[model samples]
Target: MAGSQGPLVLGPMLRYIGETDATVWVETAEPGVVTVKADGREWRAPTFSVMGHHYALVVVDGLAPGDELPYAVRFGDVVVWPLADSRFPPPRIRTIDRSRPTRLLFGSCRTSVPHDREGNSSNGVDALRALALALADGEEAWPDVVAFLGDQVYADATSEAMRDFIAERRDITQPPGEEIKDYEEYAHLYGLAWSDEAIRWLLSTLPSCMIFDDHDIRDDWNTSWTWQEEINQTSWWHERLMGGLSAYWVYQHLGNLPPAELARDEVYAQVLAAGSGDGAEGSGIDLTEPVFDLSRRVDRHPEVYRWSYRRELGDCRLVVVDSRAARVLDPDRRSMLDPDEMAWLDEQLTGDVEHLFIGTSLPFLLPPGLHDFEAIDEVLAQGAHGRLVAAAAERARQTIDLEHWAAFNEGFAEVFDMVIDVARGNRGRAPSTVLFLSGDVHNSYVAEVTDAAARHGAQSRIVQAVCSPIRNPMPRVVRVLMSAFARSLVRPMHFIAARSRRVPDPAFPWLVTDGPWFDNCLAEATIQGPDVAIVWRGGEVRDGDDLHPVLTTVGAVRIPGGLDDGARAGESAADGRPTVAR
Candidate 1:
């Protein structure tokens, strides 16, 4: 607890039940009476403490879908919304029309750094920021939902505001002091992360869904057995992990899920089911006790719970996977997802939606060059050349821990098969496009998975569209080097892996036929008539104060027949695209 402040944040906004009835969750700068009003109605929810942070989950339920409603928050009769540096206006209620398909603007990985002083000098337009600006300027169309894929904040990379808050509460001069290593520090980190002006307003107005990535806890989270081994040995690791997971429930996770799911969620069910009477507003079921126990239980028995969640819009279903925390870290058998999680994903993919969107924080497909490098590393890990293999394996384990899908071969293969099965029409009616929407690589690009045997009427093309580092950008040199290396070595690396017995060949051989280029971009995909059109728009810095955001059209692909076409017609269009033949 630092000095008491007044402005409360009503955000991490989620629109459910057609955007008319939105669920707004908030944290008070100070414990006080928090009330919300939407559609001329007011609801009061009690705020409670968790390691010094006070939070309230208010469901602004009951409103007309497809209509915009204005809402505001009050703390003890005084308006305390949009704390300071207000970059945007108050939230306007909006609704979704299920009869027609919707445009979903999604991306992840944002750091809480101050925007450039001139504002125009900001190197790249943040995806979220750009959306806000667009809405403010009355852009033509708005995305129905903004899926914030992952890493909304970096717990390890504490900002100055977070550092100041921590220092004020406890003497960091002591060993292991300044850095956040416990529940208390995590509480403050959440405050700084979500308390931004533009993002808060955007979240409040637009419907949002979210998942977590490594920086949400720590960098290179759950890449391999060796990486886990190293992290577990650190003295502060347990507290850090526990704090991160616990705070995640209170701050982020609880709001993203629907009311029905929350009621069924084991831990959250307890929170919702608990009630305390006796004229005490802040007094309710103690969130800390169950939260701590649940975090520990999930950590010890990772299989007992699941962080993955799914949402369906019209005929489309979006499955978001939790790559970290729910990992099987055995050296002999490793996977990003446990068996239970994989099974859930398998079931979700068995459908014929107009569009099937699989959202993962990590990209399912990496650059061809990077993919080859990983295969080479895996071969060495399997005893390629005595100690050289062993040493190379160790370094590879650490370096690769932070990125790529190759590290989690088993789980990756499971998803691969599931996706391939859907594309091949093993499922009911294959979707127009099995679109994989992802972010984590810090750069954005689009890759399509075409079936080689599809020309013979076997299967359709599956596309992967990535929008990453919504706010973060890699250095120019690093970007150039990565592209150069991927282009030069991808083929040779794939050859070595395919020839070696250590790494099994994938069911569908994927090639980066379009691009391995880097750009701060946002991808937009919409189903128009029978065809699904996808376009990648890269952001360009403007020359003057009022420069329009430039969106470079990188690529677009169309899936011929829409969702209604049965397996017979699906086979023809599915195999119509040319395979990336080596």
Candidate 2:
């Protein structure tokens, strides 16, 4: 068995499993009897794989509601602890608070460069790392949970460490060498990606939930069916997907769901109900086997299984949409979520909670200019822009390089309807805030949603808060152009599209009333009391031993409960929206 080396990485962490007893899972480097001790009880999940990515799920049941308890894990004779750089103070515990409204820290598009401590010139601090540091330093209070929106790892955008690891494991001179192309390589990539100190500690200490974006597989994946077809024809496409999806299952997906849910899952049930918990003759399960067989079937027929995950925290319910794999690729009927998945999303959006947080890797609402550009290009895809422009647009789509909800109108409409219905109180009490947290565009901003109050009058309510690139920053030129384009052109196009399509566009011609810029940043929102406030803070940039994780205020927007009524009556308060000073 391989001995543990480096810092014990305890993350993609999660906190506050809500009123229900929590179930924890981890993949160990060496399997020597792993046990999770919490709530004064210990549960053991025997090791099943020799590769050291041991999957163990411990169910911490029968706990009192709204109680915070410290917990720890043990591996054989050695005690496996959360990293020293943990964000929240170390006793590695869970707080089960139901009365306090949940505070969720969410953002995505983070890259894992070597931490500065290793003498490796790194990209600034990880946004999650900064948040962790803040929590540890008491600069910021701990959130009830952290939801990692997407792109946790870029299989296509591999790092030096990832490339080197792949080189040692397999002969790269072979057809798909030097980069990850299959299940075996993907498994190795995950191991390299998560082996970090700050992140490990963060994951171990916080209860994090995650979903996948394009980079999680490849950039701009599933923009259209044409893109899917083009990628499928590539020499290394099959292996790449197999590795990507398989690793996702082991590293991310399994941990997001409750043990009971997993047990009920057909695939996981086979693994659990297996007699010896090993790949025995009559055991009926083997997790180490290539996930290609399973992933391929799902890709071919997305309706067969759904990878989306959901959880309820007190009065708030979070629905994480699986935008990539579950897409409907048919030419005539294209959408982000297929019918079944959409129905599942609709069901989850019903009136059981005070707030609904929909986590999609791509923002449902993008900069208006970008949205229009995509809409125009999509029209070109259908042969509207003569031949040359149409061909060029189609090429871009085939290469997987488009963004915006219009690319998948079917799915966009479904989500839009969900938002509208929820806002209109069709789904229980309209959440105090129907907030969307997203990351793919690489720049972060927040926008509020408004509907025509009097059969065509602008009345706003829905809000979108975006945080991106926990490390990766966009090029200066691209950023300038995007900012200008969004400010000038995009806003008008949204209104035009709404009118031309005869769809009820609830969006107002909004500006970046907050920010259109920021370096790698993490976003946090608190739903405590009757008020909701969302804030974004940039990450720290270090030079030598001088760590500068400055918390620059990007923008803070507050949604007051009575403001909607005031706005409707034309009784405008400060800044026109009913917001109290933060």
Candidate 3:
């Protein structure tokens, strides 16, 4: 039965759709059986509570491949979904078709705000909303999956609505201020981030996968050892970290796993096995303490829980790495991934698929100039120039956000060697392209190792494509700086790198192939047989219609299905600008 409170709270988000089974995750108003009906079949799951918030992850099984069936969600006996006035079509579940090409949408760092004119003017139009509108109108074809790389919610950067909610419960003058503090606050923040009708409808129908970045907890989260020690001393860090991790498990991470892995999850099983409370609307097995304890334990030992995951979609392998967590923060030997995580990733990075997509929140291959800078900074901060210089370098590292794959040179080289192995057909049959798909720099770009199949003798096209800020745009000055680095700093950086004893010469020299575009946009990468193509799109409000912005392509590039043909396959547009490849 639907309760006095609304039947649905946040979602009926479609997550991890496979050939036979799919998951629909929802936050309900109460502890009720959430049902999903499609193609004359119904599947139901019981709601589990976390800090009084109820949720269900209904596994709809036994679907035929490539089946597109309209679905509805019911709360007990009441039909509670499709709202009654939804402007979009009824949500449908489309199972994966292995024989067909794979299309994926990816981006990161969206801030929750109103979709009004003012919000659009301030933060640019919401690219996700634009995509949703376009999809509803049948303008854009549906993607197989939407991989949200990181920063799904900015916990530190509160919007007006979030601030109001915070002020209602706590003293805004206190430590952490408007920033979220606990699981309850995180619940509300997620509601704000996903409750927009257009984006909500989009999420309900499209299969989405997500990971967390720094902004999901705070800016510069897990940047370095010093950062960890400083943040640990804060009066509120424990609650914030526990709440963020717990809420993440409930909201984002749980749905990331396939049905089998989800079933095997120990914490999920514990919640399900706990005692149900007295059949009340909001009463059930509350997992507040259990999840909090799980979060705390993982904080103490990150190896206990791996946030990194892998998906085998058709002829493509999508490996989403947990770049923020599982870091070796030791100053003497800093690495992006700890030893255990690295071992796991090593096993997953082998190539046999048509295309291999590594979805890391941090870019694995930065622009060469920027990459050299970060590598040099890492050594300087590690006492390459004595204690006082090292201290200054450490301060600069945090101040300028110099944390990326380049900062962890050892980890970078280890992965680079593995990629080289894969590209050289040492691991398996070489992929047509090895793409590092990333999104955290608040800009979009495509970079490639420019060498002939003759010169490098590699089979795959090694590439890095980044898309970010599905809503939040970077400042104008920062954009200019990034553009300058791409344009003029490569030779100068090479000279600087030659002088540094700690920095190793790269096996393959690379350069930016397409963009440094700072538009708040989403990138679509489609792998068809042996070729891959990428297009970056943003929202454009036209004729004062802020409510329904048009989805416009900002830039596009196509990687032909073949070996490296010298500079032929990697050439840019004739006019030296990003073009929409028709």
- lDDT of all predictions: 0.66, 0.65, 0.85
Better of 2 and 3 by lDDT: 3
Error of 3 at 448 (Å): 0.7
Off by over 4 Å in 1: 1-12, 15-21, 30-34, 76-89, 117-125, 163-179, 276-285, 382-388, 400-403, 452-460, 535-579
- Cand. 2 TM to true fold: 0.87
Candidate 2, residues 76-105, lDDT tens digits: the string is 555565434444466555655768767888
Off by over 4 Å in 2: 1-3, 6-16, 30-32, 50-52, 82-89, 117-122, 171-177, 275-285, 398-400, 451-460, 491-512, 546-552, 562-582
- Displacement of the residue 464 alpha carbon in candidate 1, Å: 1.1
At residue 420, candidate 1 shows an lDDT of 72
| TM of each candidate vs. truth | 0.87, 0.87, 0.95
Q: Write the per-residue lDDT of candidate 1 for residues 1-582, one digit (tens) a residue.
A: 322245564353544435445566777655655567667778666666666666666656567657676777767677665444565666766666666667777778776655443433443555555556667667637667777788887877766777787788777786356567778777666655554555566777777778889888888877667677888988778888888888888767877777677668887655445433311255344567778888999888888877888877656778888888788877577787888887888888865677788888888877666665665675566466677776778676666443367766777788887887786678977676677888888777656543433432334456666777766777787777667544666667677777877776666655554455466556666766446665555545466533345445544545454333234322323234343332
Per-residue lDDT value at 81 in model 1: 57
Sorted on lDDT, highest at the top, how do the candidates line up?
3, 1, 2
Q: Model 3 residue 473 lDDT?
A: 96
Worst 10 residues of 1 by lDDT: 563-572
